[model samples]
Every structure is written in C-alpha cells, then in structure tokens.
Target: MAIEYLGLSQINGPLVVLEGVQNAAFDEIVEMTVNGNEHRLGRVIEIYNNKAIIQVYEGTEGMALRNTHTRLTGHPMEIGVSESMLGRTFNGIGIPIDGLGDIDADKMLDVNGKPLNPVTREYPRNYIRTGLSAIDGLTTLIRGQKLPIFSGNGLPHDQLAAQIVQQASLGDDTDEKFAIVFAAMGVKYDVADFFRRTFEESGVSDHVAMFINLANDPVVERLITPKVALTLAEYLAFERGMHILVILTDMTSFAEAMREVSSSKGEIPSRKGFPGYLYSELATIYERAGIVKGSKGSVTQIPILTMPNDDITHPIPDLTGYITEGQIVLDRLLQGQSVYPPINVLPSLSRLMKDGIGKGFTREDHQDVANQLFSCYAKVGDARALASVIGEDELSPIDKKYLEFGQAFEHQFVGQDLQENRTILETLNIGWKLLGMLPRKELDRIDTKILDQYYQPADRD
Candidate 1:
C-alpha cells in the first residue's frame, strides 16, 4: 500500500505529532521532509484516536512544524539483506558505514520480525566453542542459546567480546557456514576504534557485520541499533541457512535510551526512573535468538551489559537475568589481580550447559569434570573464608587441601590470556591437573574409568 501524507503539527523535542493518521502501528517507518530535503524516516511509537506520535529519525533540529511534511509508510523500518551483507559495516540505522557503495536491495526484512512460535522452537543442544576456557569448561555456550555477559565499569568485557568473535565456531564439521553480527550502542570513539583494530588484527572482519552507534549520536538512534543488527542476523540464519552469532554490547545504554525516549513521551516511570515496560522491551530483543524446528540454521546471542555500581540487582541486569538463558559474570576483583578473563566461576552459570556437554556433544568426562570442579572449588572457597576469619591453624588438613585446590583452579584453570582459545580437551586437561593437587580420595565425582584415563599425580615427571 502507498504511504499517505499526514500533515505534521508542533515538534516536541524530536517528536512530531501527526494528524489524519489512524491505527498507526508502532515501529512503522515514516518519511519527513525539511527545508526541501526529504529525510528517509521516522518511527511511530504511540497512537491515540486518529493522532500518532512519531519520532523523527534525523531529529527535529532545523525542522519547522509548519514547513516539514510527514508521510506514513505502510511498512516498518527494514534492512536490505543478502549474502553480500557479510564483511560490511553499517551505521545504527543499517546504512553502509564502511565507505562501501550502496547495497543492492534483493530483499528487505522488517527490523521487528516475528519471533519463533513456542511449540516450534527447538531446544539448543549443541556447543559453540569460543576457545575461552572459563566459558567453555564452566559456563558452556550452547548453540541457539541467548546467553548474556555481565560486566561493570573498568572491566574487560570488550576484550572478552573480541575473543569470542575471533574464536567462536560451530562444533560440527558439516557446518561450514557461520557469521557474526555485532552492534555497539552508545560506545565511545576509542572503544569503537579498539573493536575495529582488534577485528582487523584477528582477520575475522571478513565474517563480521558491525553496526556502531557512538555516544555522541542522537539517543534515539541507539534504540534502533540492535533491532537493525538482529534483523540482519535473522536473515542470515533463517533465510540463508547459516549459523549466526549476534553480539550486542552495552545493552544498558540501549535501555537508557529507551528510558530517555519514554520520559520525553510522558510515560510513567517504573523503578529508578525507567519505563514500566522494561521487561517486555528487553524480551523483544533477547527472545529473537533460537533454533526453529526443521530449519538448518540458528541464531545465538551474547549481549553484554554493565551492571550499575557493580550491582546485579539494578534494573538493567536484573531484567536481563529474567529473560536470558544465563550470564557469564566478569569479576572486577579478579581483574584487579591481572587475570585476563576475570570470570567469577561461583556466580556464573549456563542453564543450557547440561544440553551442550558430555558424550557425543563434547567429551564423555566433560559433565563429571565440570561438576567435580565446581563442587570442590565451592568447598575450597568456604574453607578459605573460614580460614580468613579463624587462623589457618584452626582448619583441618582436608580443608587446607580444598583451599589449595581453589587457588590452583583460579590461577591455572580459570584465568588465561585474552588471546588464547583452548579446545575442550585442553580445558579439561587443565581441570584435571588442578584436581590432582588434592588427594585421589577427594575425587568422588568422576567415574573410576575416566579418572584412570585423565588423572595424573601433581608431582609426576
């Protein structure tokens, strides 16, 4: 259907109220002309009985209410998708940013595409090896899962993201098709530069499609960045039959942008001045990842967000925890100690870990090793805390052994260089070596047959 011209009246802080529009859908694309220049788009957000609230994409700056003309397109915001999108870079709005020529539009997909039906969704059962031992061994990333990485100010979440893009690959040899779509929201120029340099150095830029929204850009642009990136990911994963990994950084920024727009629109505030619909808003993005039954492709997500004041209970991380499968939590304390990954194994978890590890998926001993390690380390942490309160002389010999095991686990097994990508076998071997520091009697979790194959004496030649 052709778009109809709805006269615009009164610009309210980047918002243009449109008259003569009835039943306008949210996220529908509208074009506005200013000073004889026809800007491509605006998005419909709220509608009330023949009147629609539209956010002008190029902003209302230099736009006169009487002079600007508004046309409501029947379609929503969309991105041109094709195999050629790989190896390209786009701005927050899906326009080319890599200095590449305009994209040939073979197909256009709505940014807010429909999600998979509940009954038709397949359980994520395969592993995505990111080569980071802390993740692969402890909080395993299952293919088609929506796992988030929780970090805080001054943490190395960017390095972790780069490592994942550099090393993430499908476990099956038959799946040669894999791609990455990265979206950065409200990031600083230096941070954006670092990502580009890292990708170039790693030589994975060819497989990556990036959409960056800098901090200086209009706050409303950040709101559209992730949706545009995911639109492309869905196209690659479902339409092209390729395994797609979507990496979105600083989701808190995205949420903040939402709050800013909501405030401007006079919506009632929820907790901490955020909109009341924060949970549903985040669900719209996180729920987009999954494997559909009978489709050869899947969309896996790793969304990175910084917890406010290192508080996980903050609305952004809190709401995210409710929607995502699990989180990979970065430890600021460990980072201060110069640990590269700085993953606090205790609080971090992968709810889908059970489906992705052991036997045919990874290795036979994978599950047992992970369980034994977690149990022992947890006990060791308890012993160490007790020792801190009461002197070491008050602890039993077995407790002291556990404390040593916990120390070895963090220093040797959990921590590694940001550039190193250990295979599942290498990660398990490191776990076994740390376990060997304790007496064989403490090895109660693993089967005897598996223990005989992998366990070695700590003092062995």
Candidate 2:
C-alpha cells in the first residue's frame, strides 16, 4: 500500500514540508494534488525523521499547506530516452514543446546520470572546426574537450552560440556529422525565440535538440534543464555511438538558481552567497563530456557563462576555469572596435589543441603561424603603450610596424562577416599575410625555414 500524507507542515517558496511522512527517500518523485483534482510534480530533496521537504517543479503557486495532498512516488526523476529526440524542441524538464507528439522512448533514463569512470575516458584529440578564424586558427576547439566561453553582460555570446551551432558539425552525411544538444537556462523569452528562429532558418542539421528554460519559468526547471539535456547526450554518444556537441549557455543563471534553492533549504552560504557545493555541482555537468577508451563517438562541450560586472574572479567563471580545459574570453575593448566575436586571442586558448592541430590534422605550419600571431599581437600592446607616452610619430620604425600589424590583425584576422566561413587553410594563409607587413627580422617567433617558405615582405619601405 502506498503512503499518502496530508500536508499542513510548512511552505517556503518552491519547497514544501510534509510532516509525518513514512518510507520517503531522497530525490523520490512526489505527486501533489491541489483543489481536489489539479496535480503538480515534486521531488523529495531532504528527509529527516519521516518528514520530507519537497521541491515543486511547477512551483507552489496554487497549493497551500492545508489543502494540498502529497504522495511519494518511489523512484527518482527520470526522462524518456530515444534517438527520436533529435530535431526537436523541448521544455526545461524534457517535455516536447515543438508540437511534435510524444517521443517513442526506447527506454527511460535517470536525469542524474551515472558518474563517468576516469579510467574509461580518452584524452580529446582531433579539431572541431567552427569556420571562424579567431577560433579555428588561434584557440582551436578539440573534439571531446570541455572549453568554455567567458563573456560579460551585453556581449554577443548568444549570437556567437548560434553561429557555432550552424557551423560546429562536420561531414556531409548523417552518420559522419555531430549531433548538437543545447541547453539554455534562465534566458529571456526573445533570446529563446532567437535560438529557435536561427536554428530553423539556418537549416541547422536535423541532428540538433534544444532544452530551454525562460526567465519567467520556475527556477527549479532551470536546475533540471542541463541534467536532462546531458542525459540525452550521454545516451546518444556512449550508448548509441554518435558524436555529440553540447552547448550550455548562461551557466551563471544555473549557479544563481542553485543559490536560491540552497538559501531556501537554510544552508550556509559560501563565497558570494553561493552554496559550498557549487564546485562539485558544476563538475558533475562538465565532466560528463569526453570519449570512453573504446567508444568511437565523443562528447565535446562548449559551456558559455557571462561574468557579473565583467569580473574574471567571479566565483562562477573562477570555479569553471578550474574544471574546464580552457576558455575563450570576449574583450570589451575589442567589442568597442567593432569585432564580431570580440575574442581576445592573447588570453583565450585550447589546452589540448597542441596535440590535435599539426601535420596530419590542420597544416604543417599551424603551430608556427599561431605562435607568431600571439607574439606579434602581444607586442602591439607594448608599442601602443609607448605611443601614449611619446607620440606615435616619435616611435621607432619597428614600433610603427607593430601598430599597423595590430590593426590588420584585428580588422582582418579576428573580425569576419556573419556569412563568411573560412577554412583552416584559408585562416592560416591570412595569418601569414598579416605577418608579412612587419619586417622579416621582427618575425623571430617563426622558424628560419618556415619564414623562408611563408613570409613574403610587403612594400612597407
């Protein structure tokens, strides 16, 4: 016989305390009825001495302590899993919202997926081309790696994400391409609509799925959005052997939502009023990306988070940096100069790209070109600083060249048109062309043989 309890204990925001509950387990799904017939879903978060506190996913908007009836369902939260989920749009909690009927679920999967075995993971290799020079040439995104984009407020992080979705996958066939699983949490309604409109209008591959939780939706659903999205990615990648690319945007929203739930639980807050377990909670999501030792398919991740007040030391991006492989930072200065992606190449890098992009992968001189670009760009700042003290006309000939190279690097290399899709070879060629504007001796970063081959002096004299 199932146990049903009459609730009159307490209610706090999204949480409700039900007294005298027997045989209740943590994370056990609960069914709550309001005004006799209308039902809502909840799950037990904390259990103490037969008393359970449940988080209502639909929010406790209509229910009261006295009128609500609660029943504990034995199992934890689960979502139906199947390959049919592709090319569909879903609400935060795995329910289809694209007007496409119910999924033909092959099986049900627990939203909190199993922990990945460290020994089973394969170090990521091979590059995933984004068709953008700033990334494809400088901070190459390697397959099966977890690379994050650290953006600030008002930056085009959302537009950048859509561009990535339109270009991230490779190969022309269904089996050869990568499947995209995108999760948007605590985003504005217009932002969600922009994603949908872009994906459909761009004819983004049928191997794409999105889970969205809007600003007005219940905060509890924001927490569940990423978990359910990853559950589906894991199913497709590890089990069904399909290459998966997971994009999680505005992770700051997720962290904030956690703070709200934690505060409601009366838990002690850590740094910046976030829970102490924030790091562990974030790891559970990021570490889910990678390839197992024997699996042909890999799960690569690009998690985007906007820093509060553009502070890099903020707990959200700071903790994320410790867990992720590397980050792509968007610079406000570059944005002011009218760069589309606004990627500050000096600080942004991919840790595993060195192993992925050389010889057989991208090009023979890929590493050399990237190194020279970084070295020259770094010197541009020094030349500009000296110019500020003594006028630009007073600087040495070499310093003047540095200023010119910087201008070309930003306007020509980093910035590209929205419809422009440059191949790896094309990006490398542009790098060499920019390097040519400087004197041959200034190109000390490149090897003597490489300079002899690719460096052609311009009519700067």
The lDDT per prediction is 0.87, 0.90
lDDT of 1 by residue, 105-163 (tens): 77988888886789999999888889988899999999899999999999999888988
The model with the greatest lDDT is 2
Candidate 1 — which residues are off by over 4 angstroms? 1-7, 22-25, 38-40, 172-175
Ten-residue region with minimum lDDT total, candidate 1: 1-10
Q: Lowest lDDT 10-mer window, candidate 2?
A: 169-178
Give a tens-digit lDDT track for model 2, residues 280-315: 999999988898987778889999999999999999
What residue pairs clash in candidate 2, if any at all? none
Among all candidates shown, the one with the greatest TM-score: 2
lDDT score at residue 134, model 1, on the 0-100 scale: 87
